[model samples]
Target: MDVNTRHVLIAGGGYVGMYAAFRLQKSLRKEIRRGEVTITVVEPRSYMTYQPFLPEAAAGNLEPRHVVVPLRRVLPDVQVITGRVVGIDHAEHTARIDPRDGAAYDVHYDELVVALGSVARTLPIPGLAERAIGFKQVEEAIQLRNHVLDRLDVAESTTNEETRRRALSFVFVGGGYAGVEALAELEDMARYACRYYRNFRAEDMRWVLVEAAGRILPEVGEDMGRYTVERLRKRHIDVKLNTMLESCVDGHVELSDGTRLDSDTIVWTAGVKANPVLAESDLPRDDKGRLPTEPDLRVVGAEHVWAAGDCAAVPDLTGPPNAVCSPSAQHAVRQAKVLGDNVARALKGRLLQNYEHKHVGSVASLGLHKGVAQVYGIKLRGWPAWFMHRTYHVSRMPTLNRKVRIVADWTLGLFFPREIVSLGSLQRPREEFERSALPRQFSPPASRSPELESAHAGGRPEQDGK
Candidate 1:
C-alpha cells in the first residue's frame, strides 16, 4: 500500500492536533487542491479551547465563547469528525475511531499524529471522585462560577450557621497554577459579590489551599512560591503547605494534618497524566505513560507518527542540565507550533526542526489587585505582576478577533461591575417553566385556563368529555 495515497489522520484536536492541521492545510493547499493528500481530524469536541484564560472565564473576565477556536472554521480543508480515537494499529497503519452517533470506523492513515493531550491526575482517596471538580475545560470553569455563586446564595438566606459556613467555605486541593489562579479569582469575585448580599460578608467565607508539597508553583521557583504563599496569607486565605487531602465525604474534608472542615466546594488541580488513550497504542511510552518523543517531536520508533504537548514526554534541551518539559500551556503551545511545522516539512520531504525552548519566568494571579511574577530572575509583586499576568495571557490568546474581544471584556470590567447575575434557568433550558406549569395542570381543572393549556400544549388540550 502506497503511504501517500491515503489520508493523514490527527487525533485529539487539542493544542498540537488543531495547530498541526492548520499548518498542514496551509502547506498542502496545492496538494489538497490537486487531491494528492487528505487530512482528517478525530476529536471528541468540535472546538479547541485555549486553557490559560479559563480562570478569568470562570471569574467572568472573558466571555466563554471567545476562549475557544472552532476546529471546523479554522481548518475547513480538513475533515473534522467528532469522535474518539480508540487505538492506533501502527502495524496496520490504521486508527479505530468511535463515533458518538453511529458505528466505529477503521481509518487508514498514511501518516498519524498522536496529540490526545492529558487528563487530570487523581489519587484513590475516598470521596474525591464525588466531591472534587477539575480545572481543565471551559464547562468546568463556568460550572465552578455558577456553583460558587449558588453557594453564596444559600449562605445569604440560611439561618443555620453550620450550613452557612459550609456553603461559604471553599477548599481547593493543589497549589499549581490552576489552583492558585482559581482561588485568587474566586476570592476576588466573592469579595466583590459580598457588597450585593445583605447578610453574607466576605470575611464569613473561607478560602483554603492544601498542597502535599512543601512549596507551590514549582515552575516559579521556591522563592517566588514562598512570596505567593505570603501574599495569599496576607489576604487571610488558609495556605496549608505540606498537607494532603485524606478524604472528603458528605462535605467533610479530612486533611493529613489532622484537621477537618466541612465545605461545599472542592477543586482538584494537583496534576495531570497523559490521556488513557496512550495505553491503547503501540507507541513507546515512558514510565509515567507519556509517549516518548525525539527532540524533533517524532514518535521514538514510528516513522509516520508524531507527537507533542502534555501527552508526549518532550526532551527539554534547554532545561537546567537535563529535564523533561513541564506540562504547561507555554510548552504545549510552542511545541504545537513546532510540531505543526515539522509535520508540514515531513510531508514536503524537508528537514524537521528540533524543539528546544528556554524557560521563561512564571506569573500568577494573586487576586483582583495583586499578583507575583518572576521574569529573567527579577521578582515582581503586587499590581504590576497582576497586570503582567493578564497582559501576557491575553496576548497569547490566539487570533486577533479573540484578542480584541478579551481586551474589550477587560476594558469594560474596569468601568462596569462584575456580572454576578445567576441565570440558573440557562442550565434547565425551558424545562423549569414547563415543570412548574405541568404540576399546576395536574391540579383542579378550573386552575388550568384554556389559554394556558393551548399555549403549553401547542394549541391542544387533554381529551375530556365536554
Candidate 2:
C-alpha cells in the first residue's frame, strides 16, 4: 500500500460493516485500482449474518448457511482481516487490533468506521446465568432445536407425570421481537411433532411467556400488543405480563407474581446493549455508552472517524433532542450506506451530507402464516401481516442467491410439512457412545452352577436329602 492512498478501516463486519464495505469497494473502484484508496475490514467473523431470518432458521424453514454472506466473496477488492479491534488511538491515527490467533498490531488508517454491534443484555436474577439460553447466535438456534427435541423425548419415554409435566413446560423471558418470535416458532414446531408419539399431545405441553412489561411487541403499539397477548392465550399459552423471573434454580422457575413452575428450558431475550469496546476509545460518547456522531455520521470529536449502527448514537432528526435512533437493523443498514458515501467524500475533500431518516415501521413473524406488522402507520395481522413480514425481509436479505434460496424454502413449506426431528441426543453423543462401549458395572458377570449346568446337559437336579 502507498502512503498517498486513502486507507479506510471498518471496525465490524456485521450488517453495517459488511454492507458499508461493499458500497465503498464499488464506489471507489477506480481509485483503489490506481492505488488512490484502500479498504480494510476488521471483524471476528468473516461472514455477515442476516439476523431477520433467524426465527425461520430456528423453525427449520431455512438453512442457516443461507443467512450468512461471505465478506471476501462479496468485496473482492477490499482487504478483510479476521481479528478483533481492541482500541483506537485517534490522535496517533492508529487502531489496535488483536488478530484471530496472534499478537496485537497497530493498523494505520486515514479514516475509521466503528460499527461494532450490540450484545445480549442480561439481568442479575438468580439461576439465570446457568439456566437461561439466549437467541442471539446461529449456534443458539441449533441448540434450542436440540433442547426442544430432547424434552420431547423425555416426555415420550417417562411414566412419571410430574417429571413429564416439568419436561414439557417451556418458558421464554422478554417480549421483544426476538423473544416473542422465537417462542412462537418453536412452540409451533413442538406442537406439530406430538403427532408421531403416542403419549404426547399439544395440550400436554405448556408454553409460557413471561414479560416484565405489561405488553408484548411494543413496536406495534398498545392495541396490537394486547391483541397478540389474547391470540396467544387462545392457543393455551400462559402470558404473564408484569412478572419477573425471581429464580430458575435447577429446573424450578419461580416468578415474582407467586407462581412457581418447573420447566426444562428457559430462553432469555430481553434486549441488547452496545458492545463494550466503545469505552476504550478517545471519541465522544452518549450516556448509553454509544459513540456520539454528527448528523453526517462522523464521530463528533475525532477527525476522519465515523460511527454508525448499534455502537453509535446517531441523532433522530424526527424526534426530540434527547432521542437517538433505535438500535435496529433497519436504521443500521440505511445509515451504513450514508456513512460509506461520506467516508469516500471525506477522502476527496467533498462536503458530507447529514443523515436524517424517519422510522419505517416493524414486522415480525409469529409461527406459520401468523404475524404482526406496522409499516408507514398501517397495522396488519394474521396471514397478510405474516406474508408482508416474509416479503419485506426476504427482499432485504444479503444477496440475490440467498434471497432465491429463502424464497424456495417458503415455497417448499407450502407443499410439505416441517421436519421436526429432535436431535437432542446430539449434545450428549459422547455419553451415548461411552455407554454403548462400556459394560454395566452394577451386576456380576454371568456364571453357571454345576447342578444347573448338568441339568441343561440332560441330567436331573440332585436333591439335598438324596
Candidate 3:
C-alpha cells in the first residue's frame, strides 16, 4: 500500500457522500494540492437535497432551487462525477460507473465509501407504480406542487361531478415527517390558492392521510402524535390511523378498513429502504440491503470500506443494547462528520472514534406558523414549534449560502404573498416549441397556415366533390 498516494471514491452524493468528501478535501487540502491524495464523488444528480426543506419548497414557502446544494460547487476541490455507480467490488477496489451515455467504466480507489442512501420503499399494490408519486427529492416536491395546483385547475373547469370530485380529492399514504409535512404544507397552499377561484372552497377539497400504524410520527412519542392528529382533523384533513392502502387501481383507493376514495393525487411517503444498488456490491449487507457497519462507520469484515446514512446499519452506541441507529436526517448528517473524520484518521494510521449521539427529540412543520416538536423532553406545538423546526433545519442546510437564501425567501414571504402559478408546462418545456417546430404541412388544423387549414378541412376548390 502506497502511503504517498490515496484516492477516495464516494458513491451517492447525498448527505453522507457529499459531506464525507467535503471533509476529506478540506482536511487534506495540502495533500490534495500536492497531488498525493484525491477524492471523487459519483451520483445521479449533481446536487445534494436538504430534504427537510422539501416540504416548504413544495408548498411555495421556499424556492425549489434553494433545497439542493450543487455537489460540484460545494466540493470544488474534489472530483464530482455525474453518473451512477452500478457495482462496487470492494476487494478489488474498483466500482463500475454508468454514465448517462457510453459504455460503463471502472474507477479504482484506495478506499470506498458506500453512501448510496435510501430509495422510496414501495409496495406491490396495484396502480402504485403509475399513479402514486413520491416526496423524496426536490424534483418530486416541485412536481407535486405543480401537480396539486393542476388538479385544482382541473376541478375548477370540469362540470362533471365525478371528475371534479376526483380532482379535488387527495390521498397521502404514510404519516412520518415527509408524509405529514408535505400533506399539511400543500393543503395550506391549495386552500390559500382557492380564495382566487370561483368554484373553490376549503370545504370542497378532501384531504386524507392514511397510516398503517396506529399512530403517526411515532418518533415524537404518543402524546405529540395525537396532538398532530387533532390539529389536522380540525383543519378538515381526515387522519386515518391503523389503515393500509390495500389497492389503488385506477384512482379508486381501497383502504384496509374497506374505505374507498376517488383521488387524482395519491402521494406515497410510506417509508424508505436501503438503496437497491447495494445488492450489486461485494460488501457485506444485512437482510434489509443495508451495509452492516460498526459504530465507527466502517463496514464489517471489509477492509478499505466504510458506509453511513440510510444505507448503513450503524450500531447505536447511545441507545439500548442491541440497538441500531434509525435512518433519520439527524443521524445521517452526524454520522457523516464522524465517517469523514474516521476516514481521514485511517489514512494517517490514527485511532478511530466511535460515532455516538443521543437521540434528540423531533420537529415537524405542519404549515406556515403551524408545527409540532419535542426537543430535550419538552413538548411544543403551534407557532413556537414551527419556529424551532425552521430554525434547526435552516442552520443545518449545509452551506451558509443556502441558509441565507432560505431565510431571505421566508422574510420575503412575510410581507408578500406566495405565487400560486402552476407552471405545469415546466414539466413539458418542449410542448410549445414542438408545436411550432412542426412543418405547416404536418401542423394541426387550427395552427396550420390559412391555405393549409383550408386544404386540411377539404374546402379547397380542386378537392370539392361538386
Which prediction has the highest TM-score against the true structure? 3
- For candidate 2, write residues 23-74 as lDDT tens digits: 8888889999999999999989888888877888888888878888889999
The TM-score values for the models, in the order shown, are 0.92, 0.91, 0.93
Could you give candidate 3's per-residue lDDT for residues 1-466 as a string of tens digits? 2566799989999999998998888778888888888899999999999899999999999999999999989898988888999998887889999987789999999989999999999999999998999999999998999999999999899889899899999999999999999999999999999998887687899999999999999888899999999999999999999999988889999999889989989999999999988999888988899899988999999998999999999999988987899999999999998999899899878999999999999999999999999999999999999999999999888889998999999999999998899989999999999999887764474656777766768877354565
Q: Is candidate 2 or candidate 3 better by lDDT?
A: 3
Sorting all predicted structures by lDDT, with the top scorer first, yields 3, 2, 1
lDDT of 1 by residue, 22-100 (tens): 8888888888878888999999999989887888888888898889988998898999999999988899988999997
lDDT of every model, 2 decimals:
0.88, 0.88, 0.92
Best by lDDT: 3
Q: Looking at candidate 1, what is the lDDT of residue 114?
A: 89
Off by over 4 Å in 1: 1-6, 320-322, 430-434, 437-466
Decide which is better by TM-score, 1 or 3: 3
Cα miss at 115, model 1 (Å)?
Answer: 1.0
Pairs of residues clashing in candidate 3:
none
- RMSD to the true structure for each prediction, in A, is 5.3, 4.6, 4.4
Model 2 stretches astray by more than 4 angstroms: 425-466
Question: Ten consecutive residues with minimal summed lDDT in candidate 3?
Answer: 441-450
